[model samples]
Target: MFSEKDFIAGQFNTIETASFEWSAPSNIALVKYWGKKENQIPANPSISFTLNNCKTITKLEVAKKSDVSSFSFDLLFEGKPKEDFKPKIQKFFERIEKYCPFLKEYHFKIDTQNTFPHSSGIASSASGMAALAMNIMSLEKALNPAMTEEYFFAKASFLARLGSGSACRSIKGQVVVWGKHAEIDNSSDLFGVEFSDIHPSFKNFQDTILLVDKGEKQVSSTVGHDLMHNHPYSERRFAQAHENLSQMKGVLSKGNVDEFIKIVESEALTLHAMMMTSMPYFILMKPNTLEIINRLWKFRTETHIPVCFTLDAGANVHVLYPENVKEKVLQFIQDELVDYCQKGHYICDQIGDGAKQLN
Candidate 1:
């Protein structure tokens, strides 16, 4: 088990200036994590497929400074100064300061950009925080040259989780598991771990994001997660997540696409159901969201295409299917589902191998 003491850095090598850049992909949870505890600890275990095209690229420029009292940083998004983003970054720095102690010793300039539209329900936090965490870890590695590759990634994931719970899964590979489960090896609530024993049939799975609504959600994820605290069915939902994860593990290993579809779709609906049944009873899904889902169901039923849909705390629909049926499913989407999207816009993505440092 890793503790706060383990991640604290020792004496660092002297450095005048350093710059690092990274791109991290967003992920879609197969077993959704709805609630949280203190310090971003998840109420239930979750698994996700790291996405390819939808990502955030972040560049960090760090210079040593004499004043170590507080963190100093300038922030930019897509080449424009974004004052509203500073508070979130400031909070993230505060949360991770103990783990990465060198934060206060440097003045940072962060320039970030996202491949997909921000606040459009694509989980910019996951990719953005993961990219920023990777850049921070790069500086840490520069200070401590002896750090191993495994430790670097594990600690990066740990730091990312401090920023956003789902961000931890964006740090590594085609499949990642966050939060501890009895069956998964090396799984921990502290950081996400890669799941590498997946069957070939699940490899390169396609994910087409249908933009049901392109505007910001009415309720933020933090508020939605908090509602679970007083939710009547929170306990049952957490338990169901565990059982579904176990079943998913078997389905992934055995290459059962049919069972995979069932579990994935059920988990997505259960996530929203929790929101609808909460105290405030808010719904994130739009009319087009349901239309797209129903059309997907009809298409899948008639064609037996094995395609499925999942939601990510928003009105957008993630249409998932195997590589084998890409042509048919994509055709069905273009012919039927594109009209439901905002401005006929959608992104075609696939399972990816997590984040990577840029040259």
Candidate 2:
């Protein structure tokens, strides 16, 4: 168990200037986490597959400042100054400054870019915030060289969660659990934990994301999470998530692909269902989203491919399947599903180890 004091940095060795770079991947939830409590804590535990190919790479350069009165930073996206993104970064700094006391003592230059489209519903905030957190931890590790490897990643995930709840899951790869569960040892509400035990069948899992609609979502995930506060079915939904997570553990351990498909697809639909039943009642899925899903269902039924779908908080559909069926699944996606995508746009990715340090 960790508390706020565990993360507070002590006196640091004097450093004039330093730079660090890291790349963090986005994750797709199998058991979705919808609501939250105070301080970005998840209302229910969730598990996800860390993704490859679609990620955010961030480089942080810091110079010591004479005045430590306020946090100062400049943001760049894809090598271009991005003023619009400053407010979010500023909020993140404010949230994490208490944990990382050196924030106000340095002027930071944050240069970031994404492998996937910026806001194409690929959880850019997750990857972006996660990458930034890893870079910050690198700087901290330099200041305090005695920091252990375990504490380093755990604190990094802790900081990432303040920026975006799901970003915590992006810190570790293949499988990660984000909320505290009785069955999952060492799980916490503060930071995500890597799930090491798994059936070999889950290794190298494939995820082909179909871009049905690239536009920004009608209702942001933040607001959607807020709605759960007063939702009539919120308690039941939270309980269901816990049960689903337990079942998922068994499914993954036993290599039950058919059961995996059922749980994954149901969780995706349940996520959207929560949105539609909210007070304002909004739908993020486009017509093409439904078309692609029906086609996927038909393909899976006729071919018995064990392919399934999961969703983030957007209209994009993530097609999930085992690696052994990669060729057949890709062929099916191209033949029947590509037309439903936006301009036939899709990204082929697989499960990957979490974040990596560039320098």
lDDT of 1 by residue, 147-221 (tens): 989889999999999999999999988999999999999888889999887888899999999988888889999
lDDT of 2 by residue, 188-287 (tens): 9999999988899899999999998888887899999999999888999999999999999999998898999999999999999999998977899989
What are the models' TM-scores?
Answer: 0.98, 0.99
Q: Where does candidate 2 have its weakest 10-residue lDDT segment? A: 116-125
Report lDDT per candidate: 0.93, 0.93
Model 1 poorest ten-residue lDDT run = 1-10
TM-score of 1: 0.98
Count of backbone clashes, every candidate in sequence: 0, 0
**What pairs collide in candidate 1?**
none
Model 1 steric clash total? 0
